[model samples]
Target: MPEGPSVRKFHRLVSPFVGQQVVKTGGSSKKLNPAGFQSLWLQDTQVHGKKLFLRFDPDEEIVSPGNNPLSEPLQKEWKEEAGHHQEVSEQSSRSPGGDDAVPSGGDGLRCLWGDTPAGGAERWLQVSFGLFGSIWGNEFSRAKKANKRGDWRDPVPRLVLHFGGGGFLAFYNCQMVWSSSSPVVRPTSDILSEKFHRGQALEALGREQPVCYTLLDQRYFSGLGNIIKNEALFRAGIHPLSPGSLLGLPRLKALVDHVVAFSAGWLRGKFQGRQQHTQIYQKEWCPAGHQVVKEALGPPGGFQRLTWWCPQCQPRLSLDEPEQVAPSSGARAPSTQSLALEGP
Candidate 1:
C-alpha cells in the first residue's frame, strides 16, 4: 500500500478541482460498497496520513431529469447496481470530534460527512488505497467505465465524478466512503513533520512490547506502514521484535530519527525518479553478508504481515537478568548504542 507521503501526492493532484460544481457522482469498489453518491459542488481536499478526504458543499439541487443537462449520463451509473443513495448516518455525521465513528464494519475505507459544530454543513468523500488500490484523475472526454470487478471498462472510468460544466474526474480501483467514525481532521504533526513530538514518540515507544509494534502504531507515526517499519528498524540497527523498553534512549532515538529521515527520503526518491534503496526489506541477504531473518507478526488472529531484518545487525537485548541492564517495564534507560546483545 502507498503510505502517507503517497497519499499526499493524491491530495496535490486533485486540489485544483476545488470549487468545481459536481454534476453527477457515483462509483463502486469491492470494499467501499457505496450505496450511491448524488451530485454536489466540490469545496476542498485534504490529506491526513495515508487517507485522502474530499469536501463537498451540502446544498444539493435536485432537478427534473428533463431539465437537467447530461441527465442521462449522470443517472446512468448512479443507480448502477440498484443500491442508489449512499447517505451519512445522522448519528455518525453529527458527532462532535467524530470519535464515536466506528472504523471496522464496512469497506476498506470510511468517511463521516455532515454538520460541523458551528452550524456550517459539509459532506466528505474519504479514501484509502489499500495494498493494490490505485487512484487517478482524468478528463471526462477520456474517462472509461468500470467492469463488474472494479476494473476499468474499455474507455469509461472506474469511478466518475461529472461536474456541472461537462468536466469530470475519473477514479480507478480506489476505495471511497462518506461515513466513518475515524476523525477526518489530521493531527498537527505527522512523524516526518518538522515539529515531530519527541516526547510523544518516546512515551508511545516506552514499553516492553515489541519495538515494531510502536513503530507501526498510527498514534505514534500516523503514516508509518509495514515497509517503513522494516526499513527504519534496519537503518537504526534495531530488531523488529526487540523489546521497546530495552532499546536505551540512544538506540530508541536512533530508530525514531531514521523513521523520519527514511520517510522523507521515500518522497524524495519519487522526485528523483527512483525509490530509496532498501537494505533488508524483502531481501534474502544483508549488505554486510548476514542471512536475513523474517517474521510474521500482528495482534492474535489478525492476518500477519511479513517483517524482515538482519538479525546480526539488529540484536535483541536480554530480558533475563538485572545484571544485563535491561530497564524495568516502567524504568527509562540512559542513552547508549553500545549495549550488549542478548544471547539467543
Candidate 2:
C-alpha cells in the first residue's frame, strides 16, 4: 500500500492536469476485477488525496455514481464567498475609489489583481474511488485498479466503472472527500486551530472507523497506510502492539508530530531528522548490527500486519511502558507491573 509520501507525490504530479478535457481512447485493465469503468469521456478534472476526480457524462444515464456527501458545506462556503465578492463589487462603485480602483479579473479570486471580465463560477463534476478506487493512463492497459475489494464504492456505486476515455486513478487509501469542496468560512480566530493542533490525533476520523489498527487511523496522522505504520513504529522504538491509550498523551502527540515530519522527509526520499537514509525499514539488515526481525500475524488491531524490529539494536521494552494486558488467566492483574519480552 502507498503511504503519505507516495500519495503526496501523486497529488503533485496530477494536479497540473486539472480542467483539461480528455476522452477514453482505450479501456481499463482486464485483471482489475469487476472491470466496471472504461471508454468514457472525462470532465471535472481534479485530484484529491491520490485519486483523480473527473466526471464521466455518458450519452446514457451513468450506472454507478459516486458523490461526496461531506463536501456540501464546502460547496456552500464557496458560493457564499462568491456572493460576498459580488456584494463588495456593487458597494465599491459608491465608494470614493469608484470603478477605477475596483477591477475585475477574468477569474473569480484573480479579479483583485487587475481589470478583466470576471469568469463565472468554475464548476467541476467529479467521480471518486473512495478508499481503494484507481484509474490508469491510456498506455496502462495491464495496470491494476488499486482497490478491488472493500466498499470502495459508495451507497450508489457498488460496481460499474464510468466508460469514458478520461478519468483519474489512484492507490489504496486516498482521501477523495477532502477535495470535493472548499470550506465556506475561513478561520476567524486562532483558538480552534490551536486546540486542534494541540490535540489532533484523537479527533474523529473522517472515514475508516470502528478500527483499532493504529496505522489506518487518519486521525492520528493524515495519509498514513500500512507501510508507514510498519516502519514508523520501528523507527520510533515502539512496539506495533502498543495501544494508543497506553502510548501516553505526550508520547502520542510526539508520535503524531514525528509522523508528519517524517512523512514529508520520506516523500522527498530522505530521512526525518538524520541526513542519512532510513535506519531500518525495508533494508537488507539492521544498520545497528543486529538481526532484523519480521512477524506476520493477525494483530489485535485487525489487519494481518507485518512488524520488523531488531532485538540487539532496539532495546527490550517493559510492558509497563505500554500498559501490557495480562493473558486470559483467572489471576488478578497488577496496575503497574513491569513485563518483559521473551528472549529470542
Best-performing candidate as measured by lDDT: 1
Give the alpha carbon lDDT tens digit for every residue of 95-130 in model 1: 011221123334434333322212234555666554
Residue range 105-132, candidate 2, lDDT tens digits = 3322221111111232222222223333
Q: What's model 1's TM-score?
A: 0.66
**Each prediction's TM-score versus the true structure:** 0.66, 0.47
lDDT of each: 0.54, 0.33
Model number with the top TM-score: 1
The regions of model 2 sitting more than 4 angstroms off are: 29-52, 55-198, 202-212, 270-277, 297-301, 313-316, 321-344
Which stretches in model 1 have alpha-carbon errors above 4 Å?
24-26, 30-38, 58-120, 139-158, 163-168, 179-189, 320-344
Error of 1 at 103 (Å): 11
